[model samples]
Target chain A: MSRATILSAILSNQPQTTQLPEDLQFDCPAKAAVTEKFIQMINLIGGRVVEIQRIEDINLYATAHYGAGERLITPIEELDFYTQFAGDEDPHQFENIAFAVFKTHFAVAENGAVWITEDRMGARVLPFICQHLGMLVFEDSIVSNMHEAYQLIGSQDYGFGTFIAGPSKTADIEQSLVLGAHGARSIIIFLLKKEL
Target chain B: MSSIKHPELSDIFNKDEERVNWHDDTLWWIRAKRDKAAHGISEWELLRETASQIKNNVLSNLHNYLIEFEEKAQKNGIKVHWAANAEEHNKIVLSLLQGKGINQMVKSKSMLTEECHLNEYLESNGIDVIDSDLGERIVQLAKEPPSHIVLPCIHKKKEEIGQLFHEHLGTEAGISDPQVLTETARIHLRKTFLTRRSALTGVNFAVAETGEFVVCTNEGNADMGAHLADIHIACMGIEKLIPKKKHLSVFLRLLTRSATGQPITTYSSHFKKPRKGQEMHIVLVDNGRSVQLGREDFRNSLKCIRCGACMNTCPVYRRSGGHSYHNAIAGPIGAILAPNLDMKEYADLPFASTLCGSCTNVCPVKIDIHDQLYKWRQVIVKEGYTSSAKTVAMKVMDFTLSSPTRFKLAGKIGRWTLKHAPFTVNNRLNLWFKNREMPEAPEESFSEWYKRNNSI
Candidate 1:
């Protein structure tokens, strides 16, 4: 077949196998539980959590959220805020945020790690931005190694994907272990109950 | 015009032994970063191998893949252009801008543009181009090419950058802090980003399966420029394609770790389809790459992901500096690749290295950069492309080294002369003695010492 036809056939078949998971549904009790879970998850990932009654109210953690309050929300805004904030304050804050919230299909509970598809986050930046990142995962999605993670995702979709383990940890300066030089400092996994 | 050699800068390498040491340390620092990031994942080496194989497949099937990418891109309302050479690439890009009647453009970091000198070409044709990436902008303001690929203006000190920002961006004249300087560039480029009608970017990888191109940058400049511009142009060489999306996982794993030691770039953007009312174009430039592909021994050089891991790990590139290579690209990888584009013009570049294998060792995709440099030296010598002085020296050495008696006699006389007359052998005028002290001759030569010690 012609390359165009082959590509179209590939792309047309893509959505069939790889639909974005359906909008998550939650009961009132489940919602309350998830909220608490999210706060606990954030704390687990090294972010100090402050509760706000409404989403509009700025939890100092939320108001000071890197990309949250921007007029023109280009992907660049989030990236700019993180780059400057990382260099100025704790560099790992942005990375920790990126690790926490950006959607992930897989999580490794053993190490409190997250495996993100490239589609949910832009190629590399999503994993590096955000001070405290929250990863939403179905309980059954946990994997032992990246090899199994790759097999489960298959080979068709996602422009680029990465398996990020924990936050930006480094031993670069004089072999002194420095956690989070440029990427996430901590990764929090929120394992959701699997749907029937 | 006579090869544009930088003999003056060569003195820096010759004078300070410390230059080599600093170079080694800087590269090793980057190398250490790579190790730290790679060790985080258990399958890191396997991923590197997979990425390498995928790229190899792309290169072997490049001609077909380009045709495939062009057809799909065209169907998606994206214009695809082919340039057989650098001059052709420049002409194609200029004509595209001219066709749109756009005279101003904001560009993200595209090394292909650097290779084609796109900004200079566009300026000559009266199109003003602004580099949006802070590192690129700094190098552009300094009127110098990028010294390093990922960190373009890495050679510039913070004070120099502060001064540049002060002059151009109206920052406080005395402030020399990096954070302040970077913020100034950020504010300045924001205005350029909003105003420019067109944007151009370089492709990190182009997936054939999606007809999408990926760009990774620390700053989100590429995404900002593409999102705001009416027209988006992405320039890439034919060698950038990989077979599938899952393969990207492998490359993404290796690229950032090898480049900046980050787990991932701050922004890795995938432009699958143009936004509403935006025109997307992909320009594939050959620029002697096809000829490079034809050479069996040197073809693997094309497999470079341009992570610059090789440059960061190369002892020669760090000491000699990027400008010494005299090309848009530099370092050990550049030394081998530059000669393919212009052998006689870049004859000195390949010989500039010490043939250390650190570049090969640190390369994520495992490009045999040092070996390629060695092969290029052979090609240059065989083609009679070297300087007359070098040619004469090589021939004289070759004649002496071939004869055992002559070699032994020359060594004995050299030791006798050095021991008898210290000043004659050691002087500032001698290039080898400029930085390194000639060791004081012992009472006897190594051969004499060995012979006497063993005999006793």
Candidate 2:
């Protein structure tokens, strides 16, 4: 069988294993100013960021930006929503969601990415299927770089999680940057200063 | 000089000088972007070094990690399969789909599948496969292999893509706007993602510690397909494994920065387990990787992250185009790798380089690409894989160079013939003269000129 042959080949062919490097530390740019760097990175990645003093301000902004007719959905109990889905909710039902407002566990300032796990999202498809996405990240829950970001989530277990930096994009056609290729067209991260 | 694959194919690609220049300039622009991103990070070199070391460790302990990854992944409700070769890999995928009675599948960009020719294999076995990545879909519709790994259709022009889309996706004729065309592909692929019961993705990094895999994409197609589909299959090369989850930080940081100057891909999705009711399968394909591992000099190539940085910075790759390499993977990495798969078939690939070392510098994992290309040439020639005529010519040149009198006489005769009858050396039969002009022959050879000047 290929398995036995492949494993034996790998075992026999491998040279002496070397020790991994000790405690690799990186001096990321966001170490000094997390929010400032996060804003700069988010803009660089073609995503907008809004600083909201109050958590409730997001609903008003979403409604004002998307208007009242758009199908806005949020799993956060405190915020306003048009649809609330259960744990066992079908992801296909949210195919027409216009706005998906979800809470991100943490934000990486170096890349402007917000960590969204399956538990944070009511339906896994909501954030991706929605026309626009609003990622709610706490002001203090930001790391300097990927090193710190991975450090925080290394031990955590989840079925699925993604560090979404911006809305879906592609430069496949002659290297022309095109936004909204297959996922949310616009991504706006709201930095909530309130306690969860 | 010899009947090599890359040179023959590149000769055809070089026919369109304008397109070749455009392709070169386009990839160079990306290379510049990578430089900008790399300079932005203070610890860029450190990150590269750490990633390279981690990969070295993984390679030296690959068997243990694979076993560990399989055990943990199985515990996480993911079925793991091992395939020795491409045919076995394709058959395993086919059987999985057949077992589930799945007739159609939506797949994201998985170069492993491309390496295995999985799409063609499945199609021949009566299964329909749809490529969801915009670039992959463009090449798929054109019935062409991906020229570039990251940018599948980079060799194609916007107008050509417009025509392809107009015929396949019903886009309006002569509409070359990327924004409009991308939306059209999005709509077309969205329907496929929703309808297809099974989805396949290529694994970017498989963590042995946690038994999770990461798939990075700017379009989020992998996540969209996997999340929506009932079944998800992740095909990964044995070299994709990392020692631990913590190692991902160094790799993830280097991957997008070196690729397209992006801080991170739009979606860096981590799949640790199957979703609530979804069935996930992981296919680990050796498929010549073990043979490559056996090669001491070329084994460092297994550290590649497939970021395409090497290709972007490669002057020959940019001008000759990816298809010229004629491997599923192309460019500097492919040139070193293709020979391991079949030395005789890819004998000319290593010679397709200028050995400028730009690819070696740009590689995220620090693979000594140019050095390997140089080494592979020696290995290929030593194996007597070159044309017999070239071998005889090389032998004659070697014989003349071994003696001072013969070398001087040969040089004197060569310059004399070139000066007296330029057509004798600058004819169609001479490969060097085919695309170049012979330098003006001096009155005296360089050594003779040096001796005369010193005596004065």
Candidate 3:
């Protein structure tokens, strides 16, 4: 009844149908330096980028920066040092995970964000609840802007997806930037060097 | 009982002159950041224009789009609920929680819930709702409402927040660093996110084409709460809808750049359907929005994305503080939107601005905010909601300005009072004389000078 009443009220009140605008692609501001701009933005937003030639390098990077006692989990099979994700645990079970390395569908250059879905995340909370996060982004997969990112993701179905640009942060206290507020404190982008 | 209006409330906020200056400078710093971020994109202006047109079209055919969104979202296995008003919205949420036998809940930053007074309502109803956003949690601990939409406790100093954390969150005293405060909150709320069965988040933009809604946040608290909860409740005003998913390209580019000068929020999470065995409920809340849609002059206010750019760019909001507006939203956008809900209660809000058009300039969707503000003044006055003194003042001005002889006489009297009886015009009763010095009274009127010069 509420739905019917609300719709009737809206129908009686809303203006006549107006046409949607034609889609137009805007040029990227940083035209040729997509990778450079990606790194710059990633650093500016308090995220780190570590260039790697192969997926095996992530294990070395992880082992050097992290220790064996910590729970370093990943969905990427190439990273042998990190434990493989089971993908079917209670979201609460992953709360103690110190590090999570997952693969992103692609990366957006302008904003330095990686597009990921629940499938890549292993669990919905894996990307958010971990103390530190590492998202693997292929160099060629870096699109210039949001338009390209959306074009790539046109009608692709996923239950949950996100564009993670940086680590969790807030500026609530007098505009001072504070990191690790109820989510991942640090996000390191593993930029894979591949042509395609 | 009648509450304090905008002028008096702002006067209270302005009493601490140093704090007022700090607030002004802080918000201006954010506005500057926004300018820098907007300048980074070559297509920034074009992007804003495209986003505005999309919103215009969405407003024009909102009913159909809402239906489309609901149908698609339901097909995606999300339960859709409709509420005609705030009370109904709250009730639906309560019933959902009750149905699950969940006593504790977690909510992210939702101004709609703030407008509905959901926290207190739920508290009295025995449902403990914890706000998981860092800023929101700070204000929640202080027993205060959020000051700004995006930055909830911008009015609070670090020392004050540290004190609040000390008292409520069991932090060490005098811990004023933002890093420590934020970490303490993360530890405190991590348990809440893990334990709470119901999670409610604000909807940033809901795509009718894909039946998925986006929640943008820098802290990622919304995802933490929703991903872990059994029942994910998203509260959305009907105006948050866009026609298609691709339109997000234009808006996502503009949203955070306008708010805090970021390329985008750290996490722009899209929730389309619930995870296996989890319940997802989207409440399409009217809550005076349909009435706002019918108002031609004020309908564009509904197009706001709650980025708080207008607030950051608002001179009145910066100097007077966001709490002064006494609405769920504060600042220029709030001034125009509040009166539509209760004109009599918010009659003074439209008059809070200087009609500087700065809010309109920075608005990502170009809502004609200053113009709508000016229009609301006329509507409020016509509805007899303005103060009686202002009404009388308008009547006298009308009588004097409508005729030449009367205008001339009134000018003569005004000049005489200013020149001879200066106290009559330079006192507390005249609001114009408060922060400004009245100009020196001339010996003769401009018309008098012209008549004598006669050479023209």
Candidate 4:
């Protein structure tokens, strides 16, 4: 079998094994200002952040920011203005969604990315097919760097998960940045101060 | 029956001086962005070292990790396939598509697939593959291969791209705006993403601990295609496997910053298992990687994460363009890796470099790219893959330099020729004079002047 042949080949040619580094810990002096750094990074990456005192404020924020003509879909029950989408549907059905407001497990401060899984998204394509994406992340759930983020997500089970830092963009044409190549054009993160 | 080498191909690329300058400046700008992003983190060097050590551990015990990954992925309800070569990989994909009765598929940027020539193989088998990445799609429309790994169409100007879109995508002529052209591609590819039953992506890193793989993209086209499709197929080289999921932190931190100077790619999507009612398949392809692993000097080349940092920092790559390397993966990394696959075919690639060591310094995993380039040149020459002229030239150089008298005589003759008949050394016939002017010859040699002036 090719598997056996390939495996044997690799094993035969193996170099002396070196034990993995003992300490994976990295100390970042900027940990105290993770939130401030997170916001700065988000702005630089073309993502917007709105601080809300309560999760219920998302409804008013959605209406005030997106207006009535926009089609809103969310898994969060607190946002009454947005329609709660069914978990089961053809991915293509959500192609024209104007806004997708979903809850992220946690947010990484170093890169301004929120971790979301397929279960939270209802449909896998909801986050990408939508014209805009709005993520609800608790302020306390933010980690300082990717290392902390991974530590928090140790051995977690999920079919699909992603660390979405910003909206879809490209610089393919003469290296000029263009937003909304094939995914959401704009991503707005709503930071909820209260616990879920 | 014709085989052209790197020099001949680069000559063609250098025909347009303006394009060459634009390509060089654009890549250098990206390199500068990488510098800024790398500088943002205080422990960037520490992070690179940690990542390099982690890769070393993985490489030493790769067979174990691959097995563990395959076992865990299979247990997670994700199908795992192993291919000895590109042909087997392509056949596995074809059978999967055929079983599902799918005629077309959408593929994100996968240099592995490109190396396998999967698109052409599938097309020959009557399967239509649509490239979804904006840069990749631009090259696909132009009916050409990607020049750079990260920026596939970096060799193309906006006007040329506009013309390509105008001809292939039916956009208005003379429309060179990136926004309009990108939007046109977005609308055009959305239909393909929605309709295609299967999506193929290149795996950036596969974790053995959690049985998951990650695909990073700035445009989010990989997510759009994979999430929307019913089946997702990820192909990776055997060297892409990491020991654990936590290793991702170091690799991801270093990946985008080194590639395009971004803090991180826009989307770093992880696939642990198949989505509900959908199928996910991971193919581990050897395709001469095992042979590369057996070679000690070149095994470090497998540590590359396909970030294209070396290509951006490469002076030759920037000036001659990525296509000049004439391989699926080009630039400094490609030059070393290509010769391992085919010595005779890519013998010229190793010599294409100037050994400035910039590529090695910029490498995220510290591949020792320039050192490997030097080694490959020796290997190629030893294997008799070099041209006869170069071999003869080396022999004459050795005969003259090995003897003191012959060296002194040769130096005298060379200086005399340069001083007396300057035109003999400063003409088109002289390869060195092609792009440079001959230096002035002094009346006396430095050694001669030193001997005459010394009283002791």
lDDT of 2 at B64: 98
- Residues A99-164 of candidate 1: C-alpha lDDT, one tens digit per residue: 235446764322233555544643234455433444445555565433344456664354334444
User: In model 1 chain B, where is the ten-residue run with the lowest total lDDT?
Assistant: B1-10
lDDT tens per residue, model 3, B1-456: 132388888999999999999999999999999999999887788888889999999989988899999999999999999999999999999999999999999999999999999999999999999999888998999899999999999999999999999999899998999888888888989988988988999999999988899999999999999999999999999999999898998999999999999999999999998998799999999999899999999999998999999999898999888888989999999999999888888888999999999999999999999999999999988988888888889999999999999999988998998999998878898889988988889989999999999977
Q: List candidate 3 stretches off by more than 4 Å.
A: A27-32, A81-86, B1-4
Global lDDT of each candidate: 0.65, 0.90, 0.91, 0.90
**Could you say which candidate leads in DockQ?**
3
Regions of candidate 1 where Cα sits further than 4 Å from its true position: A1-196, B1-7, B12-25, B442-456
CA deviation > 4 Å runs, candidate 4: A28-32, A67-69, A81-86, A194-196, B1-4
Docking level of model 3: high
Docking band of candidate 4 = high
lDDT of 2 by residue, B8-29 (tens): 7888999999999999999999
At residue A146, candidate 2 shows an lDDT of 85
- Model 4: per-residue Cα lDDT over A76-138, one tens digit each: 777785555565577888877888899999988888889998879878888999999899988
Q: Candidate 1 chain A — worst ten consecutive residues by lDDT sum?
A: A15-24
Taking the candidates one at a time, how many backbone clashes does each contain? 22, 0, 0, 0
Model 2 chain B is weakest, by summed lDDT over 10 consecutive residues, at: B1-10
**Residue range B1-456, candidate 4, lDDT tens digits:** 113477788889999999899999999999999999999888899888888889999889998999999999998899999899999999999999999999899999999999999999999999999999999998998899999999999999999999999999999999999999999999999988988989999999999987899999988899998988888999999999999888899998999999999889999999998877789999999999889988999999989999999999999999999888989999999999998888888889999999999999989998899999999989988988888878988999999999988988888888899889999989987889978889877777777889889957
Model 3 chain B is weakest, by summed lDDT over 10 consecutive residues, at: B1-10
**Candidate 4 chain B, run of 10 with poorest lDDT:** B1-10
Share of true Cα-Cα contacts across chains kept by each model: 0.02, 0.85, 0.89, 0.84
Docking class of 1: incorrect
Q: Per-residue CA lDDT of candidate 2, range A1-196, in tens?
A: 6889999999998879987866477665543388889989999898998889887888789768776677888888778784566666666777788888888999999899999898888878778888889999888888888889888996998988889998899999999999998889989999876554
